[model samples]
Target: MALAAVVAVTALLVSYREVALSADGLRSQAAPAVQDVAATRLALLRADWEANWVKENLNGVPAAGESYQSQLSAADQSLSRLAERTSDDLGTINGLLDSYGTSITDGALYYHDDRPIQDQKFREAGSLLIRSDVGLVPRLDKLQNGQMDRAERLATMGALGYTGWVVAELALLVLALTLLSALWVLRDRCGRDYNPWLLSSLVLTVALAVVPLLAMTVTQRHLDNARDKLTAITTVAKQTERETKVDTTDARVRLDGAQTRVSKTSQEVRKELSAHEWQNSVYYGALGGGILVFLLPATGIGRRLNADYWRAR
Candidate 1:
């Protein structure tokens, strides 16, 4: 039982190691990559918004420059940060960011000065932001999907880890209970009410068993929390991408569909993630608990047989 406890612990520690790494990797890797894409997409969206606003109010020149400039400046900061981190390896993405920023900046400038942007020029900047997006969006999609994939894998491993914990704890529990029962039986059979060594062993076994059970309860809660949050964020981001990065063929239609799906889809995804987390934890408990209940006596029997064989030899 002690050896089994060690194995169970090792399995859990090794398996859930990736959970921490996944969180870190998403922040360090996926965040930068995907945020760049998102920022560019937002720039595209904003540029389009600016163009549309101008065309609608060309004669009036409405007082929207402050809000529009604020958005552009914020986007510029994001791009500027990306620029500071550029390398040969990041040339593709760097170029895309630069082009996207240029389009947004130029359009904002023309709109700010209230200069007439020729028909092609007005659309050209927005079009470049969109066109440049072609090279970047898919990579961001992959990174986004990859983060969730890692999370799912961790959830599976966490479930398995909890299962192992349960199994080891059950073995220890049964061993403790049987020994405690044997103490009473020995009082009837051999006239000894207690054996100090047996009492000590039983106490130790129960302590060990209880520890894992308690620890696993906490572990399950953490797994549930991380899994649910990651799922919610991933779902929302995916839906947002679908809405914001519409393709040339029916961008409006796709955007509308994506917008419509956001609320319902996010709710459904969150529900599924929550249900899955609960199911995995429950299974971990059941399988671990059942094995302890049904098969633990065999451990006792095997130990006794080994002891007897050594004595006979």
Candidate 2:
């Protein structure tokens, strides 16, 4: 029993370590660096558009302003693609883009009319653009905080898993000692008789050995499957990242590939976990069944009589 306990504890510790490492690896693959860079570029493009809008629209549609707007729209599209790949924060960007578009349209209308621009309307539109850009800073900050929280939680789990391993080891050691002592006592008391007590000890030793082996095999198999899935996703992601870095490099594409890899790996790990749980159920059931089988002969009438007649009283 003590030996069995030790094996169980060791198995559990190994499993925990494997899981924590897998989780940390996944998180590292999905780092937010790509999104951060994309966001910075997007903000810069928006700022440039705003600056030009302020100057060029002061006296109605300057051709230079019109040209800058076209360039701004293209930049916005690039930013939008980045947003699509990384997050849904594009809603904020979209709002800003819409405000900028509306102001441009309004300014064009006034340009056609040759009417003096109403300062209040222009100010309101400008304010909307400013607010839109400012809104992004806060949202990005929130995203950074979220990423930090994720990283911290993962780190804590790793620490806890290591701690759990220590506790499990101690528990297992104690259990093994108890079991060995019990076996020793059984051996001495049942010295010559092939009676129920003797049989029970043999059966227990058999069960203690077999059950853990079965459980360990199943657990190892599960861990292997999880590792394979993680490997496949990583390979795909790495390939994509490499391709994206060719001549006309695009950070957004590279980031998108990395995210895909991490997401797929996480999914596979989760699936393997569910499967491992079912395997655990079967293993425990088998252990219980084996124990019951071992107890049956000891409960027989003949064995009971023999134990009563000759057993150490």
Candidate 3:
């Protein structure tokens, strides 16, 4: 009874610590990418707003004291930061924005007249800005796609934490079979009811199995939270950009809050990922292969060999 209790306690402790550390590492890895996603969406919104400003002011009539020039600038700055970590084609992104900016600026020069007039040059420039604005969204989508791929990979690795459940299950299955075999062997060879070590091993493996299932479940929940928050922020950004009459102050505040949540959750995933040791193939192979070495003797194999020795004698 004491041995079984000890085994259960030890297994629980090991499993809990392993799962917690893995979860932390995962959170840490996802943090930066989540931040980038938020930034990219924000940039897209600003660039579109810049174009909108040009459309509204096509007749040399600026939006009554509203300087709508900084959206694109903010977008450019955000993209520049994201480009450092992402393989996205920065040249294309920056080029599109530059073209839009140049078109709108050059077209405005045609509006030098004091009265409202849709000069041919102004119309052409405004059209060019619109075309560029439309094209920009697709390019931004492409960049976001690339980022999602990387995050998915990281999420998969973080999901490896769930494999602890699988491994523990396998270990339990082995223990179950081994338990049955031990019962047969003990009854035939020594008239014992059960082998204490085999019973202890069963308890230990069962305890280990339970924790990983819970660990993996928790990991999945966090992953979903992080992903949903990111999607919400991006969707909201697109909506804010598309709407012609939005409360800029309120929309901005909501987007900011959503981005903050995304950031927090991403950090949590990266932290879970950092705790895993067998991150690569070689280390995983070594850990798994090493299990067989201890497993054979720790189970009933040793007793079987001893039983054979006495029978031979």
Candidate 4:
């Protein structure tokens, strides 16, 4: 019975740990990487749109140039953040962005001089930004997809871990019942009241079984909420990507709103996952508590056997 209890406790601990780790990875690394990549892509799109708007309108050069610079800065910041978190080599994307910026700047210079080459420069820059192949946008999209894939894998692992936890809980309940039955048998055979040590072990077993179950329930809820928010952000981003032009104020306003929502949802996910801080404490407590539960039952049974041996002697 003691061995069974130990095994059950170990299984519970391992399973719950897996869930916690997966949740942490999803929250801390994968989710954030996805957000960063998406942000970068959005910023680049807006900046290119601004540049194109200026080229076509031949007016609002000051305002449009300011917006373009601001968007490019935003994209740079997002890329820096992404580089810190991701293992992917961002050198290619960075090089492409630099070349794209140069083309846009040259286009502006040509426009100022009324050079015929202004159109060519703008077209080249636009192609570098949005060409279906070997463009900055496509590269970022590839990175974002990879990050999303990682987040999905982590979420799946957490779910599998939850399933494992349920199995462990069932095993623990069975072992607890078996131990209690054995205790009851000993009490009847020896003509004594219930053993205190074994009784305490039963209480500990109940605690070990119940506490983590509740904690895991809460963790799973948070994980699901985070996943939902991330999906919403992805959907919004894809919608924004489909826009052919952002020349009108209304189009630009919509893009701004979408970006704001993505940022807000990302923040909410981080806040929700932060509530998982208690998982580490619960995990360690379960380890110690499980050992004590095992020891108490063994001590109680050993005492009973020793007493019987003396009586026989």
What lDDT does candidate 1 reach at residue 164?
A: 60
Q: Pick the candidate with the highest TM-score.
A: 4
- Candidate 2: tens digits of C-alpha lDDT, residues 209-295: 455445545555555655455445434444543454363245444544454455566566666545444444544554554454334
Question: How does model 3 fare in lDDT?
Answer: 0.51
Q: Which ten residues in a row have the lowest lDDT in candidate 2?
A: 29-38
* Tens digits of lDDT, candidate 1, 1-313: 3454344334444333334344334334433433443444344344455545555455235554444455456555655554543332445555654665565445554544554554445566555444443544454444446545655554444565556655655555556666767667656765654655455556545544564355445554555555565565545546655555554455444434433444354344344333333434433553454345334444544565576689779
TM-scores of the candidates are: 0.53, 0.38, 0.58, 0.92
Q: Clash pairs of candidate 2? A: 2-175, 2-176
Best by lDDT: 4
Off by over 4 Å in 1: 1-69, 72-91, 111-124, 132-136, 158-163, 173-204, 214-218, 237-313
RMSD of 1: 9.0
Native-to-model Cα distance after best TM-score fit, residue 193 in candidate 2, in Å: 7.8
lDDT tens readout by residue for model 4, 1-313: 8667867888899988887998899878988998888888888877877777677766425545777778888988999998988999999998888888888867764464565677788888888888886899888878888888888777765456757777788878887898789777878876878989889888888998899888877887788788877778777777787863533556677778878988999999899888888899999999988888888888988998899899999
Find the 10 residues in a row with the least total lDDT in model 3.
278-287
* Predicted structure 2, TM vs. truth: 0.38
Candidates ranked, most accurate by TM-score first: 4, 3, 1, 2
